[model samples]
Target: MMKGLYCLQNAIKWYEDRFCVRFTPTVIYALYPKEEEYGWPQPWPNPDSAGIYIFLDSNKTIVYIGKASQMGARLDHYFGYGENGKCILKDKRVDDISYVQCYSCSQEEPYACLSLEEYLISEMNPKYNKTGRTEW
Candidate 1:
Protein backbone atom coordinates (compact mmCIF):
# COMPACT_ATOMS: atom_id res chain seq x y z
CA MET A 1 0.00 0.00 0.00
CA MET A 2 2.77 2.36 0.85
CA LYS A 3 4.47 1.63 -2.42
CA GLY A 4 1.28 2.31 -4.30
CA LEU A 5 0.70 5.50 -2.39
CA TYR A 6 4.24 6.55 -3.07
CA CYS A 7 3.78 5.94 -6.75
CA LEU A 8 0.58 7.93 -6.78
CA GLN A 9 2.22 10.79 -4.97
CA ASN A 10 4.97 10.75 -7.55
CA ALA A 11 2.41 10.65 -10.32
CA ILE A 12 0.72 13.74 -8.94
CA LYS A 13 4.04 15.47 -8.78
CA TRP A 14 4.81 14.45 -12.29
CA TYR A 15 1.48 15.82 -13.47
CA GLU A 16 2.18 19.14 -11.82
CA ASP A 17 5.68 19.32 -13.23
CA ARG A 18 4.62 18.40 -16.69
CA PHE A 19 1.61 20.67 -16.78
CA CYS A 20 3.09 23.53 -14.73
CA VAL A 21 -0.01 23.47 -12.57
CA ARG A 22 -0.55 21.75 -9.25
CA PHE A 23 -3.86 20.22 -8.31
CA THR A 24 -4.06 19.06 -4.73
CA PRO A 25 -6.28 16.02 -4.28
CA THR A 26 -8.72 15.67 -1.42
CA VAL A 27 -8.65 12.11 -0.16
CA ILE A 28 -11.81 10.55 1.25
CA TYR A 29 -11.48 7.24 3.08
CA ALA A 30 -13.99 4.49 3.85
CA LEU A 31 -16.55 5.84 1.41
CA TYR A 32 -17.63 2.44 0.07
CA PRO A 33 -20.50 0.83 1.93
CA LYS A 34 -21.11 -2.87 2.31
CA GLU A 35 -24.12 -4.70 0.88
CA GLU A 36 -25.84 -4.80 4.26
CA GLU A 37 -25.22 -1.14 4.90
CA TYR A 38 -27.99 1.37 4.36
CA GLY A 39 -25.97 3.88 2.38
CA TRP A 40 -22.74 5.75 2.25
CA PRO A 41 -21.45 6.81 5.66
CA GLN A 42 -22.10 10.24 7.06
CA PRO A 43 -19.93 13.28 6.30
CA TRP A 44 -19.47 12.33 2.69
CA PRO A 45 -17.09 14.46 0.72
CA ASN A 46 -18.64 17.56 -0.81
CA PRO A 47 -19.45 16.37 -4.32
CA ASP A 48 -21.47 19.26 -5.74
CA SER A 49 -18.67 20.37 -7.94
CA ALA A 50 -16.74 19.53 -11.08
CA GLY A 51 -13.47 17.67 -11.29
CA ILE A 52 -11.69 14.37 -11.64
CA TYR A 53 -12.37 11.43 -9.30
CA ILE A 54 -9.91 8.65 -8.59
CA PHE A 55 -11.03 5.28 -7.31
CA LEU A 56 -8.52 3.48 -5.12
CA ASP A 57 -8.50 -0.11 -3.96
CA SER A 58 -7.54 -1.48 -0.56
CA ASN A 59 -3.90 -1.53 -1.58
CA LYS A 60 -4.07 2.22 -2.44
CA THR A 61 -3.70 1.35 -6.11
CA ILE A 62 -5.85 3.39 -8.42
CA VAL A 63 -8.51 1.24 -10.08
CA TYR A 64 -10.28 3.88 -12.16
CA ILE A 65 -10.07 7.53 -13.13
CA GLY A 66 -13.06 9.55 -14.25
CA LYS A 67 -14.03 13.15 -14.99
CA ALA A 68 -17.42 14.69 -14.34
CA SER A 69 -18.90 18.09 -14.86
CA GLN A 70 -21.29 17.39 -11.99
CA MET A 71 -19.35 15.41 -9.45
CA GLY A 72 -22.20 14.81 -7.01
CA ALA A 73 -24.81 13.74 -9.52
CA ARG A 74 -22.40 11.53 -11.39
CA LEU A 75 -21.27 9.87 -8.19
CA ASP A 76 -24.85 9.37 -7.09
CA HIS A 77 -25.71 7.75 -10.41
CA TYR A 78 -22.97 5.23 -9.69
CA PHE A 79 -23.57 4.71 -5.98
CA GLY A 80 -27.27 5.43 -5.71
CA TYR A 81 -28.45 2.22 -7.37
CA GLY A 82 -29.25 4.00 -10.60
CA GLU A 83 -29.21 2.18 -13.96
CA ASN A 84 -29.16 -1.14 -12.10
CA GLY A 85 -25.92 -0.18 -10.45
CA LYS A 86 -23.96 -0.61 -13.66
CA CYS A 87 -20.94 1.35 -12.55
CA ILE A 88 -17.25 0.87 -12.16
CA LEU A 89 -17.34 0.41 -8.39
CA LYS A 90 -19.87 -2.41 -8.57
CA ASP A 91 -17.46 -5.36 -8.39
CA LYS A 92 -14.22 -3.60 -7.52
CA ARG A 93 -14.99 -1.93 -4.23
CA VAL A 94 -13.26 1.34 -3.59
CA ASP A 95 -11.54 1.62 -0.26
CA ASP A 96 -11.29 5.36 -0.76
CA ILE A 97 -11.68 8.16 -3.30
CA SER A 98 -9.50 11.14 -4.09
CA TYR A 99 -10.77 14.07 -6.12
CA VAL A 100 -9.36 17.26 -7.56
CA GLN A 101 -12.10 19.77 -8.20
CA CYS A 102 -11.70 22.45 -10.85
CA TYR A 103 -13.75 24.55 -13.27
CA SER A 104 -12.33 25.12 -16.68
CA CYS A 105 -11.79 28.65 -17.87
CA SER A 106 -12.74 28.23 -21.52
CA GLN A 107 -12.53 25.98 -24.59
CA GLU A 108 -9.59 28.00 -25.93
CA GLU A 109 -7.43 25.88 -23.64
CA PRO A 110 -7.90 22.26 -22.67
CA TYR A 111 -9.98 21.64 -19.57
CA ALA A 112 -7.90 21.10 -16.48
CA CYS A 113 -9.94 18.17 -15.20
CA LEU A 114 -9.86 16.38 -18.54
CA SER A 115 -6.14 16.87 -18.89
CA LEU A 116 -5.55 15.64 -15.37
CA GLU A 117 -7.79 12.62 -15.85
CA GLU A 118 -6.06 11.62 -19.05
CA TYR A 119 -2.61 12.16 -17.59
CA LEU A 120 -3.38 10.17 -14.48
CA ILE A 121 -5.00 7.40 -16.45
CA SER A 122 -2.01 7.18 -18.73
CA GLU A 123 0.52 7.39 -15.93
CA MET A 124 -1.26 5.10 -13.47
CA ASN A 125 -2.89 2.75 -15.95
CA PRO A 126 -5.88 2.31 -13.68
CA LYS A 127 -7.44 -1.12 -14.16
CA TYR A 128 -10.96 0.02 -14.99
CA ASN A 129 -10.26 2.97 -17.29
CA LYS A 130 -10.84 1.44 -20.70
CA THR A 131 -9.72 4.64 -22.41
CA GLY A 132 -6.29 6.21 -22.03
CA ARG A 133 -4.87 3.15 -20.24
CA THR A 134 -1.23 3.00 -21.26
CA GLU A 135 1.60 0.50 -21.08
CA TRP A 136 3.34 2.66 -18.53
Candidate 2:
Protein backbone atom coordinates (compact mmCIF):
# COMPACT_ATOMS: atom_id res chain seq x y z
CA MET A 1 0.00 0.00 0.00
CA MET A 2 2.80 2.34 0.86
CA LYS A 3 4.52 1.58 -2.43
CA GLY A 4 1.46 2.40 -4.48
CA LEU A 5 0.74 5.51 -2.51
CA TYR A 6 4.39 6.44 -2.95
CA CYS A 7 4.01 6.03 -6.69
CA LEU A 8 1.12 8.47 -6.66
CA GLN A 9 3.13 10.79 -4.47
CA ASN A 10 5.99 10.40 -6.91
CA ALA A 11 3.69 11.14 -9.81
CA ILE A 12 2.76 14.38 -8.10
CA LYS A 13 6.42 15.12 -7.42
CA TRP A 14 7.36 14.46 -11.03
CA TYR A 15 4.57 16.69 -12.25
CA GLU A 16 5.80 19.39 -9.94
CA ASP A 17 9.38 18.99 -11.15
CA ARG A 18 8.46 19.31 -14.79
CA PHE A 19 5.74 21.95 -14.61
CA CYS A 20 6.85 23.61 -11.36
CA VAL A 21 3.24 23.51 -10.24
CA ARG A 22 2.49 21.65 -7.04
CA PHE A 23 -0.57 19.46 -7.32
CA THR A 24 -3.15 19.31 -4.58
CA PRO A 25 -5.59 16.45 -4.47
CA THR A 26 -9.10 17.41 -3.43
CA VAL A 27 -9.63 14.02 -1.81
CA ILE A 28 -7.43 11.10 -0.74
CA TYR A 29 -9.12 8.03 0.67
CA ALA A 30 -9.59 4.33 0.93
CA LEU A 31 -12.58 3.08 -1.09
CA TYR A 32 -15.17 2.71 1.61
CA PRO A 33 -18.88 3.29 1.24
CA LYS A 34 -20.06 6.87 1.63
CA GLU A 35 -21.75 5.84 4.86
CA GLU A 36 -18.86 3.71 6.07
CA GLU A 37 -16.90 4.18 9.26
CA TYR A 38 -13.70 5.40 7.51
CA GLY A 39 -15.83 7.79 5.40
CA TRP A 40 -15.54 9.60 2.07
CA PRO A 41 -14.15 13.01 1.30
CA GLN A 42 -15.25 15.23 4.09
CA PRO A 43 -16.58 18.67 3.26
CA TRP A 44 -17.01 17.25 -0.21
CA PRO A 45 -16.91 20.11 -2.67
CA ASN A 46 -19.04 20.48 -5.78
CA PRO A 47 -20.70 17.09 -6.20
CA ASP A 48 -21.21 17.80 -9.92
CA SER A 49 -17.71 18.94 -10.68
CA ALA A 50 -15.38 17.63 -13.39
CA GLY A 51 -12.55 15.52 -12.01
CA ILE A 52 -10.21 12.55 -12.31
CA TYR A 53 -10.04 9.47 -10.08
CA ILE A 54 -7.11 7.24 -9.26
CA PHE A 55 -8.31 3.85 -8.07
CA LEU A 56 -6.25 1.51 -5.93
CA ASP A 57 -6.74 -2.16 -5.33
CA SER A 58 -6.57 -4.42 -2.27
CA ASN A 59 -2.80 -4.52 -2.51
CA LYS A 60 -2.91 -0.74 -2.74
CA THR A 61 -1.60 -0.94 -6.27
CA ILE A 62 -3.14 1.45 -8.72
CA VAL A 63 -5.46 -0.60 -10.89
CA TYR A 64 -7.48 1.95 -12.89
CA ILE A 65 -7.59 5.62 -13.65
CA GLY A 66 -10.56 7.42 -15.15
CA LYS A 67 -12.44 10.71 -15.37
CA ALA A 68 -15.97 11.67 -14.43
CA SER A 69 -18.21 14.48 -15.59
CA GLN A 70 -19.76 14.42 -12.18
CA MET A 71 -17.46 13.03 -9.48
CA GLY A 72 -20.03 12.39 -6.79
CA ALA A 73 -22.56 10.72 -9.05
CA ARG A 74 -20.08 8.61 -10.95
CA LEU A 75 -18.31 7.42 -7.82
CA ASP A 76 -21.69 6.57 -6.36
CA HIS A 77 -22.36 4.43 -9.41
CA TYR A 78 -19.21 2.42 -8.85
CA PHE A 79 -18.49 2.38 -5.14
CA GLY A 80 -21.93 2.90 -3.67
CA TYR A 81 -24.05 1.01 -6.20
CA GLY A 82 -25.50 -2.51 -6.44
CA GLU A 83 -24.12 -5.97 -5.84
CA ASN A 84 -23.96 -6.69 -9.57
CA GLY A 85 -23.47 -3.18 -10.79
CA LYS A 86 -22.46 -2.57 -14.40
CA CYS A 87 -20.16 0.32 -13.74
CA ILE A 88 -16.39 0.10 -14.19
CA LEU A 89 -15.82 -0.81 -10.57
CA LYS A 90 -18.06 -3.86 -10.91
CA ASP A 91 -15.27 -6.34 -11.71
CA LYS A 92 -12.49 -4.72 -9.71
CA ARG A 93 -13.11 -3.71 -6.13
CA VAL A 94 -11.07 -0.66 -5.43
CA ASP A 95 -9.46 -0.35 -2.01
CA ASP A 96 -8.59 3.31 -2.23
CA ILE A 97 -9.76 6.39 -4.09
CA SER A 98 -7.77 9.52 -4.84
CA TYR A 99 -9.18 12.45 -6.74
CA VAL A 100 -8.26 15.71 -8.36
CA GLN A 101 -11.13 18.08 -8.88
CA CYS A 102 -10.23 19.60 -12.20
CA TYR A 103 -10.68 23.05 -13.69
CA SER A 104 -8.99 25.30 -16.24
CA CYS A 105 -8.53 28.97 -16.95
CA SER A 106 -8.39 28.42 -20.69
CA GLN A 107 -11.42 27.46 -22.78
CA GLU A 108 -9.84 24.13 -23.75
CA GLU A 109 -9.88 22.63 -20.26
CA PRO A 110 -11.99 19.69 -21.28
CA TYR A 111 -9.46 18.76 -23.91
CA ALA A 112 -6.72 19.25 -21.35
CA CYS A 113 -8.55 16.99 -18.97
CA LEU A 114 -8.53 14.32 -21.64
CA SER A 115 -4.84 14.93 -22.05
CA LEU A 116 -4.40 14.58 -18.30
CA GLU A 117 -6.12 11.22 -18.51
CA GLU A 118 -3.72 10.20 -21.23
CA TYR A 119 -0.78 11.55 -19.32
CA LEU A 120 -1.77 9.75 -16.14
CA ILE A 121 -2.42 6.55 -18.05
CA SER A 122 1.05 6.85 -19.43
CA GLU A 123 2.69 7.73 -16.17
CA MET A 124 0.75 5.51 -13.77
CA ASN A 125 0.33 2.56 -16.14
CA PRO A 126 -2.60 1.08 -14.25
CA LYS A 127 -3.49 -2.56 -14.96
CA TYR A 128 -7.23 -2.22 -15.68
CA ASN A 129 -6.99 0.58 -18.23
CA LYS A 130 -6.89 -1.79 -21.19
CA THR A 131 -7.65 0.88 -23.76
CA GLY A 132 -4.64 2.97 -24.77
CA ARG A 133 -2.75 2.16 -21.58
CA THR A 134 0.70 3.70 -21.78
CA GLU A 135 3.85 2.84 -19.79
CA TRP A 136 6.86 4.61 -18.32
Candidate 3:
Protein backbone atom coordinates (compact mmCIF):
# COMPACT_ATOMS: atom_id res chain seq x y z
CA MET A 1 0.00 0.00 0.00
CA MET A 2 0.94 3.66 -0.19
CA LYS A 3 1.53 3.79 3.54
CA GLY A 4 4.27 1.16 3.29
CA LEU A 5 5.84 2.89 0.29
CA TYR A 6 5.64 6.20 2.14
CA CYS A 7 7.71 4.75 4.93
CA LEU A 8 10.26 3.50 2.40
CA GLN A 9 10.49 6.87 0.72
CA ASN A 10 10.97 8.52 4.08
CA ALA A 11 13.67 6.02 4.93
CA ILE A 12 15.47 6.77 1.67
CA LYS A 13 15.35 10.49 2.37
CA TRP A 14 16.54 10.00 5.90
CA TYR A 15 19.47 7.89 4.82
CA GLU A 16 20.48 10.32 2.10
CA ASP A 17 20.18 13.37 4.35
CA ARG A 18 22.13 11.75 7.17
CA PHE A 19 24.86 10.21 5.09
CA CYS A 20 25.00 12.83 2.35
CA VAL A 21 24.93 10.09 -0.29
CA ARG A 22 22.51 8.98 -2.95
CA PHE A 23 20.35 5.88 -2.42
CA THR A 24 17.95 5.36 -5.20
CA PRO A 25 15.87 2.20 -5.65
CA THR A 26 15.14 1.37 -9.25
CA VAL A 27 12.21 -1.06 -9.00
CA ILE A 28 9.51 -1.27 -6.35
CA TYR A 29 6.68 -3.77 -6.35
CA ALA A 30 3.96 -4.51 -3.84
CA LEU A 31 2.91 -8.19 -3.90
CA TYR A 32 -0.23 -9.59 -2.43
CA PRO A 33 -0.85 -13.26 -1.74
CA LYS A 34 -2.35 -15.20 -4.60
CA GLU A 35 -5.76 -16.74 -4.05
CA GLU A 36 -4.60 -20.15 -5.23
CA GLU A 37 -0.92 -20.17 -4.46
CA TYR A 38 1.35 -20.33 -1.44
CA GLY A 39 4.61 -19.03 -2.75
CA TRP A 40 6.35 -15.81 -3.70
CA PRO A 41 4.86 -13.93 -6.58
CA GLN A 42 5.37 -15.72 -9.86
CA PRO A 43 7.46 -14.06 -12.55
CA TRP A 44 9.02 -11.72 -10.04
CA PRO A 45 10.00 -8.50 -11.73
CA ASN A 46 13.55 -8.46 -10.48
CA PRO A 47 15.42 -11.63 -9.71
CA ASP A 48 19.04 -10.59 -9.55
CA SER A 49 19.13 -7.09 -8.08
CA ALA A 50 20.24 -6.47 -4.53
CA GLY A 51 17.53 -4.85 -2.46
CA ILE A 52 15.37 -4.80 0.64
CA TYR A 53 11.90 -6.13 1.24
CA ILE A 54 9.23 -5.34 3.79
CA PHE A 55 6.47 -7.58 5.07
CA LEU A 56 3.19 -6.00 6.00
CA ASP A 57 0.21 -7.34 7.86
CA SER A 58 -3.33 -7.31 6.59
CA ASN A 59 -3.86 -3.96 8.22
CA LYS A 60 -0.91 -2.61 6.22
CA THR A 61 1.38 -2.42 9.24
CA ILE A 62 4.97 -3.26 8.47
CA VAL A 63 6.06 -6.33 10.41
CA TYR A 64 9.42 -7.32 8.98
CA ILE A 65 12.35 -5.91 7.04
CA GLY A 66 14.99 -7.91 5.20
CA LYS A 67 17.63 -7.59 2.46
CA ALA A 68 19.20 -9.92 -0.05
CA SER A 69 21.47 -9.95 -3.05
CA GLN A 70 18.89 -11.84 -5.06
CA MET A 71 15.52 -10.40 -4.21
CA GLY A 72 13.42 -12.95 -6.08
CA ALA A 73 15.21 -16.00 -4.76
CA ARG A 74 15.19 -14.66 -1.24
CA LEU A 75 11.47 -14.21 -1.40
CA ASP A 76 11.01 -17.65 -2.90
CA HIS A 77 12.90 -19.19 -0.02
CA TYR A 78 10.40 -17.70 2.38
CA PHE A 79 7.11 -18.13 0.55
CA GLY A 80 7.82 -21.11 -1.60
CA TYR A 81 6.77 -24.53 -0.41
CA GLY A 82 8.78 -27.63 -1.11
CA GLU A 83 7.71 -30.49 -3.32
CA ASN A 84 6.37 -32.16 -0.20
CA GLY A 85 4.22 -29.12 0.36
CA LYS A 86 6.15 -27.88 3.36
CA CYS A 87 7.29 -24.32 3.70
CA ILE A 88 10.85 -23.55 4.61
CA LEU A 89 10.48 -22.93 8.28
CA LYS A 90 11.25 -19.40 9.31
CA ASP A 91 10.01 -16.87 11.81
CA LYS A 92 6.40 -17.70 12.66
CA ARG A 93 5.62 -14.11 11.80
CA VAL A 94 5.57 -15.08 8.11
CA ASP A 95 2.03 -16.30 8.56
CA ASP A 96 1.00 -12.84 9.62
CA ILE A 97 2.41 -11.30 6.48
CA SER A 98 -0.27 -10.52 3.96
CA TYR A 99 1.70 -8.31 1.63
CA VAL A 100 5.28 -7.71 0.60
CA GLN A 101 6.94 -4.53 -0.66
CA CYS A 102 10.11 -5.13 -2.60
CA TYR A 103 12.53 -2.31 -3.42
CA SER A 104 15.31 -3.32 -5.73
CA CYS A 105 18.35 -1.27 -6.60
CA SER A 106 20.96 -1.77 -9.27
CA GLN A 107 23.74 -4.30 -8.73
CA GLU A 108 25.95 -1.31 -8.09
CA GLU A 109 23.92 -0.36 -5.03
CA PRO A 110 24.55 -3.24 -2.68
CA TYR A 111 25.58 -0.84 0.06
CA ALA A 112 22.37 1.03 -0.46
CA CYS A 113 20.45 -2.16 0.16
CA LEU A 114 22.19 -2.83 3.45
CA SER A 115 22.07 0.72 4.76
CA LEU A 116 18.52 1.35 3.75
CA GLU A 117 17.39 -1.88 5.35
CA GLU A 118 19.10 -0.94 8.61
CA TYR A 119 17.73 2.56 8.60
CA LEU A 120 14.19 1.45 7.87
CA ILE A 121 14.25 -1.22 10.55
CA SER A 122 15.43 1.32 13.06
CA GLU A 123 12.90 3.94 12.16
CA MET A 124 9.91 1.67 11.54
CA ASN A 125 10.71 -0.82 14.29
CA PRO A 126 9.28 -3.75 12.40
CA LYS A 127 8.38 -6.49 14.87
CA TYR A 128 10.00 -9.31 12.90
CA ASN A 129 13.43 -7.70 12.78
CA LYS A 130 15.50 -8.53 15.82
CA THR A 131 18.03 -5.74 15.63
CA GLY A 132 18.22 -2.03 14.82
CA ARG A 133 14.77 -1.38 16.14
CA THR A 134 14.30 1.85 18.03
CA GLU A 135 12.26 1.69 21.18
CA TRP A 136 9.28 3.94 21.17
TM-score of each: 0.61, 0.58, 0.69
Candidate 3 lands at a TM-score of: 0.69
Model with the higher lDDT, candidate 1 or 2: 1
TM accuracy, model 1: 0.61
Regions of candidate 1 where Cα sits further than 4 Å from its true position: 1-3, 32-39, 81-110, 133-136
Best by lDDT: 3
Highest TM-score against the true fold, candidate: 3
Candidate 3 runs further than 4 Å off: 1-4, 17-41, 81-93, 132-136
CA lDDT for candidate 3: 0.66
Of 2 and 3, the candidate ahead on lDDT is: 3
Off by more than 4 A, model 2: 1-3, 16-23, 33-37, 40-46, 81-110, 131-136
**Collision pairs in model 2:** none
Candidate 2 per-residue lDDT over residues 13-92, each given as its tens digit: 67547754433465445444343423343433345666566666555577677776666776666644444532233434
Better of 2 and 3 by TM-score: 3
Residue-level lDDT of model 1, residues 1-136, one tens digit each, is 1225567678777776887765545544444444553224433244655666666665556766777776666666545333533233433354344322222222333367777777666776776665554222
In model 3, how large is the Cα lDDT of residue 92?
49
Model 3 C-alpha RMSD vs. true structure (Å) is 5.0
